[model samples]
Target: MVHHRPRTRERCPLWARRARASTPLRTLLLGLLLTLAAGPISMGATDGGGIGGTGITGFGPIQGFGSIFVNAREYFLRADTRITVDGRAAGRRALHVGDMVVVRGTADPARTTGWADVVQVRHPLVGRVDAVSAGGAHLTVLGQGVRIPAGVPVVGGDGHTVALHAGDWVAVSALANARDEWIATRVALRYPAGSVPAGVPAVIEGRVASVGPNGVLRIGTQAVRLEGAAAHKSAPAPGARIRVVGRYRDGVILASRLAPARPALGGPGRYVEMEGYAVPRAAGGLHSNGILLRPPGGKEGAGPTGIRADRALVFTGRIGPDGSLEIERMEPPHAPELPHAGAGGGERGFGGHGTHGIERPELERPRIERPELEQPRIERPEIGRPRIERPEIVRPEIEIPQAQRPEIPEVEMPGH
Candidate 1:
């Protein structure tokens, strides 16, 4: 679940690795010892075979058995690749499609495919913060519930762990326990109002228009590049649904994960779209235009501040339990008078406010890699990381000289 108020597109992804054991007792004992030596053990769970390779980590839905598509890159699994469910060892066959997973591995130089040692069931959500509990332990995004344990990295656009308020967009990966409750990690925040974000985190769900060789494709107006060996080797034609997890930097979305998408219907609900100066309570101090225009059965909060106020900004999302429109997505500003739209009014009670931006006639899309794929090179998992044994520590014995021991012998003679 991803929510956005306004601004941006596309991003990148990095991943992690895994290892398994044929010896169950060895695996367990190693895990226990490592836990005692280290700390709490989490996914990729029990800690054995932590030798060599790049420690790549990423989170998203599983594309298939052979890969975990994270953002634009794919993480390939090796014969020794390991699997874990909430920190416990698992069989490779334990996972399925549509199940969200967080992968840790070592990536190749090409930045596409690499060896993954660990994969776990942990779904991530990127969306507006509908509400936060008093202590901030529990929060809601769109409508999905999330629990933030201690030390979870909560970042803001300016790169700080500022207090999260309602309507702030965030991207967080979560693990569900036996009770199906969510535990969050890798939490990121949207750039604050009026600040240019260095890295824009995003999740895109749409149909792939084309899949070039080397795992690149076009989705909506954005170009997505994939990395991994043997992942969706066949080209993706138009209408091949895909879901992307990545960051939007410069203009490209470097994917960290990828998965197939099934058509979903938003059940019967009241929806609204708005374009205006999303004046929040703080930005304008109380003069802000918060909740500008809400219908009787609708809810309204300030639109995301990421959008420039100089133009017509549009926001669309569903209403949450608190009656606030949990913004699910935003778009680049467009002309006011679209087909079926009015001069200053709206078709479905949406109100277009403020004059359009004065600057440019068109915002150019970023040039992205649309190259053909090379036959993916599948290297052995232990390619770069070698199992070098640690040298043992030894101490040499020192002999005491007779002269040095003489003073103690003389004192002993006096005592005798």
Candidate 2:
């Protein structure tokens, strides 16, 4: 059973001004006192857990009191140590073994564990992936209630399902029993790309020109295909700029629905690299963005701060009209080196780069050429434990005379 909730936001008040007013002398004195006595501060949840609170905006586990959690929908501040700590801790903190936390915020129906302002982070799992099918080449994780397809959009580490090939290692969270199968709401691959940004699946606002009979919409010169039943109802007038959730499919984008036009951050000519799976190439050698990159193991509704690309490459151009990236260049990463062959033959003919003719000795020759050491000898039993008997020590009969011994000399100190 999945419970859907509304999103929340984070708010920061006049705490900045108060900190700025305090001078170095006062700050130093305060620091000294804090060092001597460690106790919780009583400020709002935006001042770094000081007398005020702290902002939990970035990654990593956050520690401290009075934390603030923010996202697109809303902001929230709670007294709970985990909530007050940071966003990353929401899972570990809110979802303890048996703790129950109530959440009130906007819910994303499409994804399980999607991002929310997180009014509350409590025990048990929240969210779900509606349908599961086998022909989609998807893998049904019997433990997490998730059916991750072969080429789903994912952000590595951020906790989203990335493209999966045979033998790929992945981490699964919130495994539940759904029928006879185990379902995982969160599925992540072991190898993930770097950080992804917030508000990705970012809104690309543009004009809507034509809606074909097939429900393919055109914005400017670009044409977009829509999925689900929402496509037909969301059609817009030709040349009408609109915004749509750029749900990517196979490297290319198919706009889900029409939305109001809005300004977008990170524009054309900005050199950026996004890692995702590569959908099969289209008729014109173009491929769809099939990457399911997120932070290594991200949940749904979470901002995409990372990605897992099927093929790693650099995107030098702007995002195209269809929401597909216009790739200026593609680069495949170099593979690791293999073990070498014998001396000359190994270095020269490795990777099929060089050819060694008949002059060089073949590698098939026996490793040991000399047969003299091959003959085995009879074994001899050891006396006791193979002890090495030392030769008898011979002592000289005469001892050294006292007169022959050198006399000792004493040196005096400066004071003496």
Candidate 3:
């Protein structure tokens, strides 16, 4: 027979000969090693994860322009990208650096670059300044207390860093600490870059404290009037956060636009990444940027202990079907250092959001002591000068001719 004999191990390739000589366990181990080497590649393609993956959403301050950067991801704004400011449709020009924004988009598997589908800029507080602290480091606006940490950029209508004052209408972009105190990142005056424009509307965003049946909604201490709104259809319930854009007249705002506030986290099932101060909830889990976070394997209503409140944290997760965040991974906490007074100027004002590294200064209040003193007893001068009896001098009266009194006209100032 001309059939070739089975190939002998000696004549076979070196790889075949070695495979024939290897034990079953060694062969299994070799196959496992190869699979492990290629695992990342196959997994990356299927799950869009593992070394490289898509970025779905992010929330943070806009780091720079060109294409908005948030949470360390650059989201390029395309022609169809929808942009909004304070719940009103706006152009990209309305966006500025240091503005806290939520970006929703699709990123390449590498996660280096992304295309933004929606960019929303929502200010934390927008209302008339109720009060400014003595040093301008703290303010009360629309019934909410705001702290202007040193180095936080305070800008005026002219777009320059300036001191905030009482009664000044402002838009505040900020972060909420665990104490529910707002730490302002940017405070911009809303009036008069030099002069107030006619019919310009003011914007207010806050939780609706109460909703009246008479079409009046109160957010903080300010009342909003919704004209032509159905009781159940357009009115937001109490405790619902919302944005109102309108003119402020008397003590009520005539809302021209009203809508539910956009949250930092996007729709359900959306993958999201955000950097924010974590505030543990009373019920359970952690809350950040308006989203509740439940750690992996955590059961509902079962709180995670040892969670630090107001500690800045970067979280990666997906939005649950109920809108809560399902945390897949949480990085170590990163707290933003409290700003201290810089050496540049004695007066602290908004410094243009430069984000200079500042050390937290020792906040010791120096004690001042006042020396108690006794009032000196001074005896009334006994020598009251004898009142010289001055003889009453007769006064002469004169009559003047009347030129017809010129009529003064009352001028009415223009109303806003």
Candidate 4:
């Protein structure tokens, strides 16, 4: 029976024992408090927003290159923001003016200014080349300078580098640089820059080059044939800048209606601004509202209004030689297309559908059948008074009582 007694609970001071047990918990709580004192981990946020936070969004045409402008405000690009054009990944410099864009970003405290976290280009500019540099590093379109950096994708009808030239119409996809210059990423030719396709009506703006063997109006070697067209029964004088709408064939565009070009007119150092609907890319190449812009002095080669010698060639008339005038401040064509006329719509030409050209809506008359009228009828409820019947009552005979009253009455009557 030499079993050792069960070991009793250890005899220790209460506070000391409790402290020993809580050592781990106190250390953990102290570490947690220290962590709480430290602030959140930092990431770059120039406009005071985190990468995961809700951001602002906007939709409009790109107002400039380098930085995107939408809804009349400018947004600079961010490093982590996604940029896409026609569903393709693109850099900030790949954005171009007049290309419709949707942007998401975080606004600064003012909200007027902000940084763009994402941008998407919906459409590219389709137009004719105003000018091209000798080395092909730069070109002009609708008075806007486009820098063709290396690695740019240039696709011709034959597929790749079709040897760009002045007077050639082209469709450009580009981005903006830090300098705000349009850095073209894709220069696709719908046709030879200046030549129009056969059998399609288009609006053209240029000087009449010459008249050919048949009745033809030449717009810089691009002839104008007066066949199957309207309002062109008469011939336009040579060297006249006119807006002609008709089908194009064999470098000749059949003139339907020829009118004097209403260019944004200006003299040297003068500013001109014109706003109009963007013509279809399929028909009108870089001819915004059928406007033809010549050089400042009305001469293209001798213009001294561009930034570079070649860049100078882009500004319509004589404003190009020295490249002095910077008139190609493109505005966004962000007006939405309306379901009905004049509600809210895309660029409507002067005096017509918010879109381009002379279009007449078809009139239709609706035939409605008249419904027949029903005869009037009055309805009344039948109400009549109810009749009640009464029951007859009979009394028992009283002969003796009646006789006694008669005797007394007779005696009194005799005495009277």
Q: List where candidate 2 sits over 4 angstroms from the true fold.
A: 1-127, 130-233, 236-265, 280-283, 290-328, 332-416
Regions of candidate 1 where Cα sits further than 4 Å from its true position: 1-123, 157-159, 178-180, 193-201, 204-416
RMSD values for the candidates in order, in angstroms, are 34.4, 30.1, 32.1, 22.3
Report model 3's TM-score to 2 decimal places.
0.62
Per-candidate TM-scores read 0.25, 0.21, 0.62, 0.28
User: Against the correct fold, how does model 2 do in TM-score?
Assistant: 0.21
Better of 3 and 4 by lDDT: 3
Order the numbered candidates by lDDT, best leading.
3, 4, 1, 2
Question: How many clashes in each structure?
Answer: 46, 77, 1, 35
Candidate ranking (TM-score, best to worst): 3, 4, 1, 2
lDDT of each: 0.48, 0.33, 0.67, 0.49
Candidate 3 stretches with Cα past 4 Å from truth are: 1-55, 108-112, 192-199, 230-240, 256-264, 303-305, 332-416
Ten consecutive residues with minimal summed lDDT in candidate 2? Answer: 348-357
Candidate with more favorable, higher TM-score: 1 or 4: 4
> How would you encode candidate 1's per-residue C-alpha lDDT over 1-416 as one tens digit per residue?
89977986545421112334356856686778778889764433222113333344444334233344433345667778778743358876555433446565665323445566667654345545668895877877644567766644466544456777776676665443323234554355654433536555555555466667667777645666664532444556776555566655555566766765421112233333322334334333111112332323433433344544432234444444544445555554233222232344211111122221111122356899989989989887665866999999899899987664444543445555
Over the stretch 1-416, how does candidate 2's per-residue lDDT look in tens digits? Answer: 99888776555553333455558866786787776688665444321222222211111011111222211111234344334111235433232111112232222222111122333321111111223356423443211234332222233343333555433333332211212122222344443222222222312334466778777776534445766645756467775545455443332236554554421213332222332223232222222222122222333323222323233232223344333445544333211112232233211101111111111121354587765666678798776866698999999699777767688999888986
Displacement of residue 72 (Cα, Å) in model 1 is 27
Candidate 3 residue lDDT tens string, 231-317: 335688787767677776765777777776546566777888776667666676667766777865567754445646645556778
